[model samples]
Target: MSIVRYLTHPQVQIDPDVPVPQWGLSPIGRARTEALAQASWLARTTQVISSGERKAIETAEIIAIRLGIMIEIREAMHENDRSATGFLKPAEFEQVADQFFAEPHLSVRGWERAIDAQARIVREAEAVLARNRPGDILFVGHGGVGTLLFCHTAGCPIDRVHDQPAGGGNLFAFARDGRQVVHGWRRMEEVAA
Candidate 1:
């Protein structure tokens, strides 16, 4: 059976003053994504969808162009809403993220609860899959919500242990029909056709 792949955008240009959603891909991120476009596995993707966030959109665009497919942006595919806290430094963000995963029910420092984000992601993903024709699909979004969705599909609990590696550019595949995760997170370049 074919698979649905969820990819997290790679490294982004960190501008402390900018809103997290507006931040785009960094130089290294662009380079890495361009390289990832060369992966043979990407040829299998017939449709590309992305979160409205700039970083994810940028990543999706790169892949879409390489695969000669148009991108469909979905607002619900966005990262866990962190607007309440704004841009926390990496160290501070990591601390809060740990809490977010540890207590899936509670909003850590005004961030969206992990369970809520998980529900939104799963719902949005299901909607996308239901409406589209059967084929390999690629969903480009953020790591936090991606992990939550992966946890759901894998029959695992919401935990950072299931999160993608730091710095992003990771993906996991799931069987399209039954929604069973075929594998854990792997770097984009590492996935085969």
Candidate 2:
């Protein structure tokens, strides 16, 4: 069966001065993405796409280079627009994130509504899959919307309980045709072909 993988960019360099969308991967994050490139399953990816944000793009670029492939960037694949609050410290961000998942229908501190972000991510992913019939497709993006998409594909409720673990660099797999989740979130290195 055709399979699609969605991966969240690994940890990022937290630069309060830099726009959150512009912040690239941290040194450790780059190392993590590079290490993930060695996964056997990544070699099978025929199409690679990423959110327009820097971190996601950086992560996608690393994998693409390893596989000798090109990356397609999609703005709709961006993390839920937390631009309302800009960059919050990790501690504060977690609190806001908790509320975001808890109330999917409501805007958390003027951030993009969870429901809205889910819709956008789902729509973009569907459109991408419709146009590409690759044997294996990979989407590199953020954790928030990734969890939302994962919930939609898995036929689960939009809840943070479905979210990936505390760090980034996690992934989920689904059947491209049926859109059924084949696997839950796991670190990139943990995935097998």
Candidate 3:
């Protein structure tokens, strides 16, 4: 059966001055993505989908290039919107993210509610899957929404407990036919294994 993998971009440049979505991947992130691009398992990836955000685009571009495929950008697959507060310090961002997941129904600090994000990501994934394309699919995007998607696919409630690890470059896989999760939050480098 074909599979779908959602990969969160790795470490970013982390500029507080830049809008979060505009921040590109850091050197480490790029290197890790390049390495993942060569994974044998990705040989079957016919469609590479990504969020419009810069970092995610960068990540998708690397793999799509290696797979000899063009990427399809889905803006609705973007991370839980946090533009309301702009950039926050690492500690502060963590606290707010915690609350964001903890209270899925409530919008924390003007951010998009977790429930809303979950629905949007799920809807976007379903739209693509409805096409019933051949070969595996790769979705390059953010950790927050990736986690939200994972939770939904795994039949779990919205919670940060399922969040990807820090520094990103994590991935999870699910069966496209039944939308059932095959794995959860493996580091990108280890996906081939």
Candidate 4:
């Protein structure tokens, strides 16, 4: 089967003083990247692509290093732009995050319109799929936007995806045969150690 795996880097860091995109994964997050690299699936991944973000780059690098391959960075693959809001202390962002998910069609507290971000993610993702013929492909990205892309590709409404499951920090698999076919999805926690 032509499989594409979408993986969000494990708990990267957020720089409260800086923008989210610029931040790299924390030490623990780095370990998680390494762990992900050890998965049997890594051997089957012919190519790895990632968001230009440091965390995604780091995560992709881990797999690349193990496989003796290189990571391709794509700006379109980046997490939805969160430049408008600086770092949100956990307590603060949490309260408003629900509202964003609750109203997928609206912007989350003016951060980025959920609908617009999802559209861009879908566009870029389709572009990636176009490049590869039918092998295992890995894309390292973020949680929220990743979910949206997966939802859209699966023909599921973006807003309702949240109700189905929490998809961030996970590996989501899809098959393409002139159409999107969801293979499987698993949160990091659910992955067998």
Q: Model-by-model lDDT, in order? A: 0.93, 0.93, 0.92, 0.74
- Which portions of model 1 miss their true places by more than 4 Å? none
Best by TM-score: 3
- Could you give the candidate ranking by lDDT, starting with the highest? 2, 1, 3, 4
> By the lDDT metric, which is better: model 2 or model 4?
2
Stretches of candidate 2 above 4 Å error?
A: none
Candidate 4, which ten residues in sequence have the lowest lDDT sum? Answer: 160-169
Candidate 4 stretches greater than 4 Å from native: 160-168, 178-184, 189-193
The per-candidate count of clashes, in order, stands at 0, 0, 0, 0
- Per-residue CA lDDT of candidate 4, range 1-26, in tens? 67777888877666677678888888
Count of clashing pairs, candidate 1: 0
Query: What is residue 80's positional error in candidate 2, in angstroms?
Result: 0.4
Candidate 2 steric clashes = 0
Error of 4 at 39 (Å): 1.4
- The better-scoring model by TM-score among 1 and 4 is 1
Pull out the clashing pairs in model 4: none
Model 2: per-residue Cα lDDT over 61-180, one tens digit each: 999999999999999899999989998988899999999999999999999999999999999999999986757999999999999999999999999999998779999999988888
* Ranking 3 against 4 by lDDT, winner: 3
Q: What are the per-residue Cα lDDT tens digits for candidate 1 across 132-185?
A: 586799999999999999999999999999999988999999999898888899
